[model samples]
Target chain A: MKTPTIRDVAQRAKVSLKTVSRVINNEPSVRANTRERVQRAIETLGYLPDLSARSLRSATSYALGVVYDNPNAYYVISVQNGVLSACREQGFGLQIHPCDSSSPRLAEELRDLVRRSRLAGLVVAPPMSERMELVRYLAANKIPFVRILSAAEDPADGYPCVYVDDRDAAYEITEHLIQLGHQRIGFLWGGVSHRSSPERFKGYESALKDYGIPLDKKLVIPGDYSFDDGFRGARRLFALRDRPTAIFGSNDEIAAGVLAAAKSCGIDVPYELSIAGFEDSPFSKQSWPALTTAKQNTEEIARHAALRLIAELRPPGDAIAAAYAKNEGFSPQLVIRDSTARARLPAAD
Target chain B: MKTPTIRDVAQRAKVSLKTVSRVINNEPSVRANTRERVQRAIETLGYLPDLSARSLRSATSYALGVVYDNPNAYYVISVQNGVLSACREQGFGLQIHPCDSSSPRLAEELRDLVRRSRLAGLVVAPPMSERMELVRYLAANKIPFVRILSAAEDPADGYPCVYVDDRDAAYEITEHLIQLGHQRIGFLWGGVSHRSSPERFKGYESALKDYGIPLDKKLVIPGDYSFDDGFRGARRLFALRDRPTAIFGSNDEIAAGVLAAAKSCGIDVPYELSIAGFEDSPFSKQSWPALTTAKQNTEEIARHAALRLIAELRPPGDAIAAAYAKNEGFSPQLVIRDSTARARLPAAD
Candidate 1:
């Protein structure tokens, strides 16, 4: 059987060969209805744009690369789903590359990935997105990319990024605890490498100041984002001479650990010590008390990042500008659940 | 910069062009050490095989498609990781296509995917793998594919499949519960469409027969493989006058639900009513009691399936035969955790 060609698609869609070419190239000039008609025609004819031919005409390929290094499977999966959704919408394929950010050969591996895959662009996920050197490398190479980041403000140099307002969300969660009559509130930190950790800490500190409560250095515990860290952090807080009435974990995984630690210590939740977490992940909802956390729409953030990257890869046009304009920062909302409540009196009595 | 050719790789690796071609094509004739050297040379030179040129030489393309329609994110992610690992090792790109099995256009959509992506083959995941009609369609089209399935036996026709012995695993889990002195155990099932559900049920029934315990219809509850279903199933069991001393969930998610339901009903886990779940998913460990369940090596199974598929795609040779010979079945191991315990006396007394 003879393979269908661009001309066949054009004939079926009642358009010129040039119009079909524009649609196939994802040019913004084509009207939405005409583009849909061409897409349907392409589907009906089983048309596959010859990648080699397309490469000869343009340097870009029809594939987008997603580079991430995250221990949280839930977060990684969510980001992939979002990126895949965007890729599918634009008739693009996704190449997921799970790499270790701390690896010595990180830059070399990324460069190799781009050259071999012939990727059109990339959607970078955290904490890889947080790496300045990697970002600089990609920028220096002029590779089209978008980053999913946790930052208080967008970079002044205008590198495309989808920012998450972790600091603001953390402050809101802390303020929620303060409003619950908790003066002595404990804070658990995630990994120092993650920008979200420091941003969230700043928010918590700001909330304490806003509520006229002195920031107790002893109440703050240093730990990573793992459940084990949350568990150990809570235990350390419990061992203190003046135990806190409320404990705020950096993320839901940490909060869930805190719940486990409390249970192990024979302490009742909410009634004795209220606890809250950041990132309304599965750990929050699956926990016994169902953690009160900030809902970070990670999937949505990733989706937008992918879309933004694709748009940037397209030729300069109104659509590309619109796509760039849509790259707005996100603020996670506070979700109150059973884990957090009014502070209780000391059980020492 | 000029593109590096296969000849360049040959020179760099200090091997003949034929050897480089053999390694690039993933032929079995290349020695392991020689193949490694060729791969390193390819990586060093940033070599990308021209897909168009390769397709002209052979019907195969350098891409593999993964088609799945699973609600369980963990399962899907694990399968992708496994498939991706194999693809990377073999220098093939992966195209993930999440589709509804019950869709009227399922076959058409699949055919379109193959034509457009120019996929050399596919890695099919359940419950799509359970659909015989889809399997027949792929076979009729002469598409190279491997299925990841949970079944009692391999099909007689011998289309490549990586089978999980769900029946054996389920029986082992049931036997563990029986030994724990829980004769009156409730059973919650997954979706009827899934072959694993019935296979697991059969194992449960077989265990009861082995122990000379009559299967109680009241104790068996129909449910999908979901947390909500587990919660509802447990509630129904609790509503019964002769409630079972223990409950067995079809999967970890369901068991986690049972844990939540038991807690809400003021029933202590393992003591008041022991609960056991199948598939040692993250849900099992994250749950408060840490579910007693069967550990399904899904990742390993998927990895094997991918390896098998890649082997099948290679030209007929000794290595290909060896790959086919390595298609061994898997039986999930029973893992005892905090959720299950000895049966207790009736609380009615």
Candidate 2:
């Protein structure tokens, strides 16, 4: 006839109050035997945890926010799926917040989101993750968070992050083209604001240098990551006196544009020119001749980011929490399809 | 510092307590002048509304759940964006819940979700929306919800819904192919469980009947809504002794598959054959030569569903709520692209 409190459950289980709280919260620190005992006591007493009250007491909610500013539907959904998987596993709720990275009021908006929702932590996605100003604001507010970033190495900013090595992936893609005897390899840049653009560019430059190929300014076109940009960039390359034997679009959308441009110009793929794209998006596989791209596991990266953020919300000194706190990295691998082949030899005198 | 209550704000603004609550929830029925007065009073008093306590008293939270079981990344993201837009405008929160419709415990899972999260209502997307058993469960539990479904007419089930006329769209697509001097047209079916498939098939059947063409069972292939289905279906049609001049895929992904199949078999599209697809998705545009398909405004439909769900959660007798309660429908328009053309005249006829 009486409502059972957490204290009652703790007493019945012969465990400390903190252990009951940990069991109720489903934290990994509670031993299996202790967890089972607490569960039995809770069932016997018909005790139900007051989730909101628990959150208020702990100064953190059982929810994680995934903040993203991506236009690509495929990329955004993949991130959502990844974060959702981690949340389901850890018994945490997910709140997906899409924001305008270029907005001046971004920090204020994010702050209000955290305060209003009482979120435990956040999983930040680029290009917001790459913005130091926003990251600094989060740190200053003492908001527990993890970022999914594009970098060759850890920034060592005393922040937990899951980073992707775009530079390394780009380098491998370039090396593949070079090995195929492509001397004039053109590159199309993604949005300048994105850290991926510069990281990928560095990889391209490194590969060119290693292969003893001189870089041509004309071959490098500056444009945002889009199908239209790829189309325009490829057209500019094709109009040159000596067109490049192959072209690399920073992302798949740009590469798709190049493929369309080639068709418009009556150029045969692989036989006349090879094309490579980053990010093995759906279109890359659906594209005619299919595309040769680097398979970047965005879902996996996002899942790791969410896991780390949730771990940070757990009690310190937990082995699982410590493992998740360590910095994580990923490098996309090459996927060869119908888009690339050996370059054609020139006619002799 | 003494915290101000809703009562104090309402008294200061010279408005009813209900009016102040309406303004706080951002309900559209609140008069502009009244809302402004309430807003000023709150700002002057530095009053912060207690969201959690308000939910407990009202028996509903200021959050709506988007329940979907779709594999299409593009479709899912569009739905989320639409729901988010409505939530932002109405000062509500959104929770994206992707459920396994086939799971035996789906009903229990959904019930737990609503109870634990205390959602105000739900915006359901197909094929979950088409499941009568699930719909009955929600209605039985007195849950305020709206469904986005494919139907030619309102089911008038007392519950509100946003429907798309897939049959009409399918009819127009088939008629376009027939008008292009094509006597033989093939059809690919989407998932049988989805209501859209049957609605589309009905349209295709009706067009053939009205055009004085006899139904050929062999020309109608059974498959799910996928690229592989389109590819396999197209191949079967191609292997026929008297192949059809055009093929209608249930959706864009299937149409893309048909295009690829044509390339694999060395068939010249539009000249030797034509292809049509439903749901003019991104791949339809990205495909070689593009695709002639129906443009379904998924975002608009989803936004309308969310609006209806939110309206149902509002207090009864509100004018805005009454307006949103009316059933709405949409017909996808035919978009002509490069994939369809007139059937080539028989040589030496």
Candidate 3:
């Protein structure tokens, strides 16, 4: 059997070849109903647009790139799925590039990736999104990109970005613990390279200050966002003469680690001790005592970023730009789970 | 700055344009040292082969597709990394297509995906790889694809495939439990759709037969490869009047579920009851009593599959085919952890 072509798709859809081409190109002139018909016909007939053949006559690319350097598999997968969803809907191919954000050649490598692949745009996720130099390079090079970042407000860095209010979400989680009468709440920080780390810490601090509880430096433990880090941090806190009654890990991975550490020390979760984590990743639910976490909806955030980048890539239009501007912010919500509970009296502790 | 061209790479590497083209095409005619020099020059000058431009004059595609339908995030990510590493090295772009294996339109969707993207070949992972119809379609259509599958021996499908010996690994795990004096051991199975499920079960049965342990239908539980299934399966096993002293889950996720169920039931792991899981996934390590599992290096398997596909895609040569044939088989090793221990005395039960 011969591979289906655009002409076959047009014939199947009962439309002219030019109309099918317009729909494939995403021309505004094509009506929505007709576009749907052509799409269905294309799917039914298994017709491919021959992007390489099309690119010969035009410079427009149908591929989108996702650039990130995070070690968390769950987070990366979620972001990739979100972006891929958007790309699929828009008939654009996704090019995933997992690169070292700290590498001196990052800018050059990214430039090479874009030029070689002819990417229509990029969806940048942290901590690559937080890199000022990379951001500047993309902007200076006129690369269409949307950044997924942790910020209280849009930085207006001359590029579209999706802002995640990590600080606010962290504050809510910390407040939940404080309200439960956890005065000596210990804090575990993620890697400093991630902008969310500082934002989350700020929220935890602000919550403590709001409750008139003086910050105790001894109760704070610094560690990267990992299970081992959480384990080590918890061990250090547990070793102190006056151990913290409650602990907050920067992410679900760390929080799960804390749970493991507590179990090893024979500390009953939410009874003798309380633990919470940020980013309601799979680890939170899989943990023995499901972690109380902030539901960041990373997938949705990534989807929005991809959509925003696609919108930016579209031909200059006021409606598209307005939609992108309005969808720039996202805030995670606190979700109470089994890992946290009311603090026990000092004597009981 | 103008995007670097193949001419620039050839000039920088002090090679003729024909030599550079041969190297880029992965022609066996190019010497190893010359290939390295051309690669370095390409990288140094950020020269993109302009796949679209090149394809206009030839039938070769610059993109490879990964077709899969797996719920395991870790598995998917590992496979993607493996394939992407191969793609990056060969200067090929990766196009990920996550599809439902059971969907009636799967074949059509995949055919469309290949045609639209002009994918050079596909690196297919199970359970999609297990579908005979899909495999037949790809072969009939002359679409190059390499399958990552679980089988005791090569299926001789005429298509290049990478096989993992799940049966032997499962037998080893069951034998490990048997050596620890476990008599009444329960078995948990993964979804029937997966070829590994039956292969693993066969191993377990063979091990039991070797030890003169009669097969007890009551001790076996059927389930999909998931945490919830593991939990439910363990619960069912524990409900039996004469409960098994040990349980073996088909995968780490299932084993982690078993651990969770055991914890909830207040059963002391490896003391009152022992548990083992297959696939040394992250869940195994993160589980409270880390699981004893089979270390099937999925990433390595995927990498080999990608390399095989790339080799097959190259201009036909005996050397490439021989390498592909030699690298087709893989065996997983058993890793014992905290989850398994000697069975307690019958009097204790």
Model 2: per-residue Cα lDDT over B49-104, one tens digit each: 65445554665587888999988888898899999999989878888999898887
**Whose DockQ is greatest here?**
3
**Candidate 1 CAPRI grade:** acceptable
- Residues A23-63 of candidate 3 have per-residue lDDT tens digits of 98778898889999999998888677788778656778888
Candidate 1 residue pairs in backbone clash? none
Return the clash pairs for model 2, or none. none
Output the better candidate (1/3) by TM-score. Answer: 3
User: What DockQ would candidate 2 receive versus the native complex?
Assistant: 0.35
Tell me the spans in candidate 2 whose CA falls farther than 4 Å from its real position.
Answer: A1-54, B1-50
With a 3 Å backbone cut-off (N, CA, C), the pairs that clash in candidate 3 are: none
RMSD of each: 4.0, 4.5, 3.6
TM-score of each: 0.90, 0.90, 0.92
Tens-place lDDT per residue, model 3, B71-165, is 88888999999998888877778988888899998887887788877889999999999999989988888888999999999888687799999
Q: What's model 1's lDDT at A82?
A: 93
> Between the candidate structures 1 and 3, which one is better when assessed by DockQ?
3
The alpha-carbon deviation from the true structure for residue A37 of candidate 1, after best TM-score superposition, in angstroms, is 12
> lDDT per residue, candidate 1, B256-313, as tens digits?
7788789879888988889988888776776667789999988888878888888888
| Cα error, candidate 3, residue A208 (Å) | 0.6
- What is candidate 3's CA lDDT for residue B65? 94
The lDDT of each candidate is 0.85, 0.88, 0.88
